[model samples]
Target: MKIHMLPTGDEVHRYQKSIVIPFKNSRKVLSTSPLNGGYRENLLSAFNHDSNPGAGISCSLRTDSYLNDLKLLATEIGLDPATATGISTAASMDNVAIKAVSYENLTVTAIVTGGVEVNGGRVGDPASYHEARGKTVMTKEGTINIILDIDADLLPGTLARALVTCTEAKTAALQELMAGSSYSRGLATGSGTDGTIIIANSQSDLKLTYAGKHSKLGELIGLAVKPAVKEALFLQTGLSPKSQHSMLRRLKRFGITEDGIWNKHGVLGEKTLAKPVFIQQLESVDREEELVALTSLYVHLLDQMDWELITPGRAAQEGRYLVERIKQKYQLDVEYTFSWQSAEETITGMLANFTDVIARISAGGPDV
Candidate 1:
């Protein structure tokens, strides 16, 4: 792999810096798969400290050991000189920079300087899927700069995680390129990893600019950690995680949404639905019982009704129509609407209303 020149501070802000990792690659055949060495080194460099006098850049500092580790990493991938992101350049330096900047809140920005065209391009023709690395490969080399803004502390291997996110983005970009949709299409053969050195300068750059509106890196980071956060939150509540439907309903009722975290649920509240107290009450009504009881009550009321009032035929017809509508649709809709809000409350209100009507009808109250 190549060792690129140390980056000048002027390229970034006080809060940001950049470094380049130079790579040596084969001119004859570029491998199309992951670089075992490159992938692993990037992860370590992200977390490892500087070997010599510390440079102002966040990641530029490298020691003899770090460099040796790179060489060793290449061996681990065990790719021929044609495929690995090598250690030195000329060899010439295969330099690429991964810059990071800390923001006001709990966040850090990791930027891979180059774009899709450089990073996502392919290298070698397909080796036999089951075959070993080629005897010898041609040599060509280039750089792809990737960027990311991490929303957390400088945890160990954070830099490596950022690199992984970059790899993912590159793969996605490659897919689009293969499908004939990217500008990088038909130009490059593979990502250069041979004889490469990464230089990270002290961070001085402040603002972030990207082609897309949102940081694709942040999205990946969120996806990586969201499940764990969710599980932790759910466990704290002492409720076994439920189906997504129930979970979302609970979150919504607790005022949780994409708008951002808010303790809208207060410090804590009674998780009524979390308990089984109302499960039986909310059990679906016996539709046949509702129908039979209403129908019999209607007949009894008719026997006691005064036919002289408001044209009995029309009145009876309208009454029957209202009963059918309630039985077939309106009552069901009301129950659903309430159930969605809170099954307990919906059932309680429903039963109370039904009972009131039944009592009034049994007492021979006004048909109106």
Candidate 2:
């Protein structure tokens, strides 16, 4: 075990299985942890544990009592289970990220462990249809667990407001990476099983009343949480902006898939290319900076049309312009065509045409 000291004079114990922050005195906390969740002032410690059940073990075969399991974990770590509240994730503690941001005397630290291999989703996405009695279903796949500690005292309202700020910051990190939603044609805000814990010093003399975006405290929180979440995600899942710079990754939210692209343009009636050749050519140009830029603009136009911020005709006009730019940039001879159907159909058709042109160019085929 390794120990690190926080700015608030508290010790953070980093163990092989968990990260524990034990409070020396009473502190105020607001959390979504299943063990001792909600507002609490007498909590002794906050923990983020790795609950990975190992390979080939199914969820049904795991322990059904989460609370009891957490209690046992707390005791094993030498923390009083009765006074501890915490969260758990399938992500390993080896991937935890610790970031601290300070302004003058105020300091905020964020500890995050993240994995989004599955269940990454945007807010308001579809839900899994199920009903459970007594115990709820838990998956040991992906979760982003956050623990925040503020050195300065804050009102209960401010602490709650800080939660909102921290959550927004987390979403901002995901947006920067353009993380996709599993359930919808949109970007993911967070994983379905994400959990957060926020702690504020109750003994500090400097008390804050507001933690909204307009405040410096909120700014610090964003500065700390956003990069911490991103770093944790990178450590745990190899997910970073560099890793997400693929045309397919960006277009997946719009219902475009590798097979969809390949099947749409892999063959021209009697002529066909091998699947490997097609994918190689497609991926070769997918990361072209210029092409990716045009794709970003095209998707933004789609978003604007969906939000009714731009008329369908305007989107079509601008979209055609972008498509033309793609052809000109790549020096590919292709014709511009639209189905003149619904706005969605028209815009998606433009994308399909754009992709088809690129694929043909990549395969060294004559313009159609």
Query: In terms of TM-score, which candidate is strongest?
Result: 2
User: Where is model 1 poorest over a 10-residue stretch in terms of lDDT?
Assistant: 24-33
- Give lDDT tens digits, candidate 1, residues 142-215: 23323233333232243444444445544443332221111221222224432222222223232222212155
Please, what's the RMSD in Å of model 2? 2.7
What are the RMSD figures for all models against the true structure?
25.5, 2.7
Whole-structure CA lDDT of model 2: 0.82
**C-alpha TM-score for every candidate:** 0.24, 0.91
User: In candidate 2, what residue range of length 10 has the lowest lDDT sum?
Assistant: 55-64
Over the stretch 241-277, how does candidate 2's per-residue lDDT look in tens digits? 8878777777878877667777667454422777787
Global lDDT of each candidate: 0.30, 0.82
